[model samples]
Target: MNAPLSLTTPAVSVDIAGVNLSYGTNHVLKDVNLAIEPGEFFAFLGPSGCGKTTLLRLIAGFNQADTGHVRIGGRDITDLPPWKRDVGMVFQSYALWPHMTVRRNVAFGLEERGVKRAEVERRVETALGLVGLAHLADRRPSQLSGGQQQRVAVARTVAIEPKVLLLDEPLSNLDAKMRVQVRRELRDLQQRLGLTTIFVTHDQEEANTICDRIAVMNDGIVQQVGTPMELYERPANLFVAGFLGTANILKGRIVGSGAERYFEIDGGTRFPIPEDDRIPDGAALVFRPQHATLTDQAGPQDGALSLPCIIANREFLGASIRYGARIGATEVAIDVPFQSGKYLFEIGSSGWLKLWPRSLHWLSV
Candidate 1:
């Protein structure tokens, strides 16, 4: 087995203190503070207009901050121009010239820097090889596939040997399968080169799959930052919980703690609380679909948060069965393995849904 890559020092680190931006009274980014380790594949994930792309532009020197400082390699470059900052950016649009050949496009940055003709050629060839586009060096952007064109754009950026690589939804144009394929390649290339990469995307799966750590942002504020598993397992709040994946939130209030920990839900249902030191009075319970199960068995039972639910609908998802159950006026989603041969419950069928106490996450109300 290949040894893991060691990151001795951070290739790029960003420290934004009280960073804020505004355009004629509209506040975009508000006091955003974040740090990215060297050789780490970091992702800024959020919905559109959440200031993720704006942050990327700030790091790339395309936009200047109004209050905070931007640093790369421990040096402040807030006042530097885009060309002076050694940061390579790949855009969603692929931004390649139609008239230029792949090789010429990759060589553009080096040539503009007054690099020798031979050295520019060598760099262009090397970058193209890195992206698996060396065989198509003579083709134009219009003649290549979406994936290939993206690779050319990547080659163009890496040819300049920038200190940080900034990608703003670079795979948004590709189809689903191609997006997956290219994403894996991008991660591999980033690892092999040991480049400090910052990727911005609204797709949660993309962020989770490629990044060493992800910063979840909403409405110009970073909600949480952690590894994929950490974020999935323990979201900081309701927004982080629902945003990262589908979650079933139960309105509840903590009544006790320790071995006698308990919580009371809105429908006058009381259940034992999960083993956690963070529980407090008046908190909410959250769990994912897989964390809760449904059964046709009887009433309130032991070791479960049992609730009477009527099956509203069912959908087969190949690997699992998804059932939409109506609990009072709200719908609760449940998932079961497809191979278990559990008979599909018909609409209007009533049953008890049991949620293990350990799977519940309690948050202050």
Candidate 2:
């Protein structure tokens, strides 16, 4: 058995300034800029083809930017090769050598760096121990479970003690239950190491639960950057409002004048705009499913706009019931808590959707 290793590595800040990358005229990345703080668990979140992976690869020196620089710990390493850049990347596939034992795989990176044989063995053992896979050091990748293989891949990267850790959809290959279990483990591991880590994923729940902050990308552009709650509560635009979660967006026109201005939607719903709220031209009315309540009364109350709608469909979620309400030609979803004896609205039932003004967000497409 090897001695336990101490991994008290200092954290480093990663800064990307005016970074732009393009494959011919494809323009993969726009004028992107970001500042990732030291020891921060940040996430690059978006749908596929959104440049999240490209940006992550750029940081690891796998992909070069057409213009701009990537600085780590106040040092510009834009021209550095992959081996020269002290950044460890865990790919989505969890690349492992099938024939090699777990300990040998973990030691591969250290060996390639010309580390002393004894030190390499010690670090490999320590890395395996850190991930709680020390007992399986002699097992080949083919004999381990998916989660164990992922831990081995992580161990391989951390054995080198990279300044920044890059994980590109690292949990994508696992089952749903395993994804949840492994994400928590990964978060725990990152916090213990105090490493500046960046995770890339398209799943909102994964990004929301594991990351401190997220940069949401779309169409090769960064749409917004903030905490999950911040982005969900205060989305910058319609795309952001729809992407982060289930948002009910309705096209409307601002009518009246001055303090008596009203937002009129096609569904014959007119909502008074508070003086403090600024409604930009061409903006749409957006709200979460739980923000509106189904009511029998047509008169609006509780500082909410009452819109007449018909229950179109219903879906039984575990703890909540989601109803599809049709307002004019537009369809919006409304969520109601499930209870043993609560009254349930049947499909085609007519009711009013009372929307609270404070919970509404005005966003543009």
Candidate 3:
């Protein structure tokens, strides 16, 4: 058996500063600045037209920033061409040549660089082996499955030994089950290669599952940047809170003061707020649906907030139950673990939703 590719490949840091981009009258990226550590699997996450892919293209030297500079391993590469930057990008389309054999596709880049024939042969064989496709090296792209084709794309990129690897929604082409399995393989391959990588995607689960840190962007601006847990639990603003996950936002007015301080939702229900001095009178209280508990009782508990609500709807998810409740004039969602024999409230049934006070987040209305 051929030896496995060494996992100790040279990884490098990536830095972007004051980057701005525009296409005529449309402004895309704005004042973006980020420093990615060597060997860190960083992700750019946002919705369509949020500039995530544009930023990735910028790093790959395909799109030029209208304003700032890009540095790889501390060297300024703002003026360099794509081939000169030593960065490999796996295109979203896979972009494999249909007529060529897998080995040729993987070796094309090295050959273009004029690597000696023997070294080219060795690297081509090693790349295919690394992707577990050495046996299929003689087959064309048409003969490979979607997942295999993706691995080929990744192998082609890595075989060039680029200082950085860029994946632009690489798994979007695969089926649900295949995407999950291939993503794990991709993560494993990245760790084994120790290459500084940037992944761009709109899927929050994809970003949270694979990346070490994520930068959440929206409308040309970065909403928040943090580890998955940090971003999910402690969002920076209303945008971050609502974007990263399902957040139940309660629009209300902060009322009363001192120990009796409370927040009264527009509908009529009031929630006690331990501290109101720092919060504005008009604001929104936010919490994740999963952090709430649905109960039929009305008693309040220490460190918890109770809301007298009626079950508006319920969804039977495979592993959990999702419920919509009406509290005063506003509606909130609560998620509870599924219990086969446990009593469940029907729609329009009176119940109470309990939320921990510490789980609440306040944001501008």
Put down candidate 3 lDDT per residue, 241-263, tens digits, no spaces: 88898999998787777888888
Overall lDDT per candidate, in order of appearance: 0.85, 0.91, 0.90
RMSD to the true structure for each prediction, in A, is: 3.5, 1.6, 1.6
- Model 1 per-residue lDDT tens digits across residues 1-365: 22332233447765666778877688888888888887889999999999999999988887777888887878888889999888899999989999999999999988999999987887887888888888899999999999999999898998888888899999999999999999999999999888889999999999999999999999889989999999999999888888898988878566766878776666666666556547656667788999888889966566777878889999999999999987765687898888766687899898889887778787655
The segments of candidate 2 whose C-alpha lies over 4 angstroms from its true place after superposition are 1-9
In candidate 2, which residue pairs clash? none
Question: Poorest 10 consecutive residues of model 1 by lDDT?
Answer: 1-10
Task: Summing lDDT over every window of 10 consecutive residues in candidate 2, give the lowest-scoring window.
Answer: 1-10
Q: Tell me the lDDT of model 3 at 157.
A: 92
The C-alpha TM-scores of every prediction are 0.92, 0.97, 0.96
**Clash pairs for candidate 3:** none
lDDT of 2 by residue, 77-100 (tens): 999998888999999998899999
Error of 2 at 285 (Å): 0.8
* TM-score: model 2 vs. ground truth: 0.97
